[model samples]
Target: MKSWRDSVRNVVPYTPGEQPKEDGVIKLNTNENPYPPSPKVLEAMKEITNLRKYPDPAVSDLTEALSSYYRIDSSEVFVGVGSDDVLAIAFLTFFNSDVPVFFPDITYSFYDVWADLFQIPFERKPLNEKFEICAQDYYGENGGVIFPNPNAPTGALLELETVRDILDHNREVLVIVDEAYIDFGGESALSLIHDYDNLLVVQTYSKSRSLAGLRIGYAMGNRELIKAMSDVKYSFNSYTMNEPSIVMGTAAIKDEEYFQDTRNKIIKTREWFQEELRELGFSFADSKANFVFAAHESIPARELFEAAKKEKIYVRYFDKPRINNYLRISIGTDEEMQALVRFFKSMMNK
Candidate 1:
């Protein structure tokens, strides 16, 4: 419609993984934590008595809590509704120049959407045949750079040295390392943020802390970069985090014991499932995230997706080139994963 702004009208939005609400459907499409949040978080959420006032524009409590947990200065932290919001604001705040930003051809699908929506030039540097990012490919000139550590869907991780190499090459332009799944089993680039002025490392509590429902994500970077992001956030929306989310997020970060227990459980389950897939003749990358991207030796990924859906099981299937044959299966509870293994065994043997 001509009534709409030209930017909104021409944009092709990012498609997230499906969220099926029906009972009995084992939801594993979105990489959400299958475990419940800490009891302390639930208790804190129940204490949201003040609904009359707006949340803190600065998101003070959660920011302070995250700062303490990560042992970083509060000025170096920025919080938003989710990593999506943080990343979106980042795209707007930075990536303004005409020079093309660079990322993996098979990385988080949202990167391209953000670039297109904002009219920022970008190039998708192809990953090697092994689905691993080549740090050298990101070496040349660019406006900005961003990629997921343990890159999504494939879950292939670039070592810390490789990450440092890319940062070394792109010192002038902004570099964002989206560590959305880093809690699963990968070294975070957060340690490099202190050294690289251009580095901004983003993470979410949705996975490890089991706070997806709270919708809180944060970034750690140099004080200057965080100030720019904060300015953009305030200009767009003064109050992003809700009272309940802030309180609950603060409580979740404090429950270190529960967080470690749940994360360890998921990692153990992922390792066990990886062995099961190997025995089933499936080929996959060594995923460090809480998901497994694997392809069956005989059965097509598309067919497996459909068959699993019929069984009331939902797994992520990307209908894109180079990765269409693979299934991105999020690690569910031990019992849920075992059920999936049994189902795969039956279907593959048949």
Candidate 2:
């Protein structure tokens, strides 16, 4: 019998959170915004009557808007289906070297899956005891460095100065910043792009903009790096970010007022939620993202996850040993957080 492709053999792909197709589950497992996208997004999609015509292969309008938003040249921007698509393109672009790609041991787990799928070599680096990125650890080896700011699952942020130090010290390596959740509250490495040509910042409209379903993400860097990623996309699927998504994406990015208000609301709710969790004997990482990483000293995370499921609430937990005891709970609205807290109070670490 013919087997599946070599890459497909016994491969455990990344498991996205349980998005129940059923009618009633409060899903907070994914770090999605609680708000719907701006009405402009709806208006834009409604205006698009032509489904037969192919989307602009270049995604020039969205790119230009994003470039103008970031004050970077349009040539330095490349839009993709999601940051995952662009990150995958990056794996193809800069990870062709024999050396292992390096990233924090506990970052977006999909980074490892992306490497496995692409058959790229990779090495994991432990984060500092404070759960912060240490630039020195990334130096002297590897083909590239990639990690989220206000890193995933943990949500611990690294300062802008530390970022500059890392890029300044590691001149040879391609430094990729996966800023999928950056809009929550963190310094963007995009600001450092003019100084370091190797820095590539990948971001999504999925988080702060409330457009995860739209599947639009873009990368910012110098023109040459953007060109390399673009080449990878063209070789695979030229018209990657389709018309509907591009339209929604443009509307999403352009709606700065909604973006700011929603992010601020999440931050406010997160602060109150953190205090409530702390009172319940839960330890959590200090976060600047839309989620908090936490576990109660008295409870096993797996138990809480299942219990929450039974209660029709969803939060994220990993089976990986170090993080198994912890849960990555997304910051929902004030009422949602209160409900989660109330449930936790009732459970009492059983």
Candidate 3:
């Protein structure tokens, strides 16, 4: 009998932070915005009552808005489900058996999982002692390069100059910057498209736009690079993205004022939360994102997370080595933060 199975055996799925269904726990495991999406987005989505017809295959309107925002040509953009899809496309279009891809060892864990799923060989280059991506070490002969700016968990930012240097020095290599978290604080590589044809910058409306549930993301690059990823997406699922998402995302971009206010609130909350954590004898990475990475000398990250859950507050804790000592707490509303702090203080006093 012929066996029917996939090459899925060796692949280990990426584990996102624990999300519990209990209503009492303050959900902060995923780095989702604590605020609601722009009112305009909700209005836009409501207009899509007819589900029988298909969405625009090209997603022309949303891409046009993104094109103007990033100041790139429309041909240089490809809209997809999320930044994760854009990254998965990058893996399919660029990574190959001929040469291995390279990324920071401590970067978004999903990158490694993507490589394994595609059977693409890859190597994890260790970040510098300061946890910055070492451009010098990345010049080795490889298939392509990919990493996140203001990387996940660590929340560290790589300056634009450093990113440009890496691109210039490795001209032949395809460089993909996952900018999912960059909008919160870091500079975007969307500005480098003119100089580097091989640079692919991925972005999501999930973060700054407070549209995590909308599942809208796009990529910017030279027309050819964008076209390559499109081919992969088109082959598998031509209309994978839905009509309501497009209507909502396009409207969200058009309403810049609401987006800014929401982003500003998140930034304010992040800064204030960082200060409060510091006062509680915690040390952590200098965050350049919507989340704060912190740890106190007295409490283990796992224990802190468990204790917070008991108080109906939940934050993220990765059991991975090195990072196991730290918790990645998403910046929530001021009241939510105060509640978390109050619980921590009471736990300590007890």
**Residue range 1-350, candidate 1, lDDT tens digits:** 57556545477888888888788989889988999999998899789999899988999889999999889999999999899999999999999999999999998999999999889999999999999999999999899999999899789888999999999999999999999999988999989988999999999988877888889899999999999999999999999899999888998999999989999999999999999999988999998999999999989999999999999999999999999999999999999999999999998774
Worst 10 residues of 2 by lDDT: 1-10
What's the best-to-worst order under TM-score?
1, 2, 3
* Residue pairs clashing, model 2: none
Report the Cα lDDT for candidate 3.
0.85
lDDT tens string, model 3, 61-180? Answer: 899988887777999999988888888888888886578888988788898899888888889998876667888878788889988998887888989999998887778879999998
Q: Give the Cα-based TM-score of candidate 3 against the true structure.
A: 0.96
Q: Which residue runs does candidate 1 get wrong by more than 4 Å?
A: 1-8
What is the model-wide C-alpha lDDT for candidate 1? 0.93
Per-candidate alpha-carbon RMSD to the true structure:
1.4, 1.7, 1.6
Off by over 4 Å in 3: 5-9
lDDT of 2: 0.87
Q: Candidate 3 — worst ten consecutive residues by lDDT sum?
A: 1-10
Backbone N/Cα/C clashes per model: 0, 0, 0
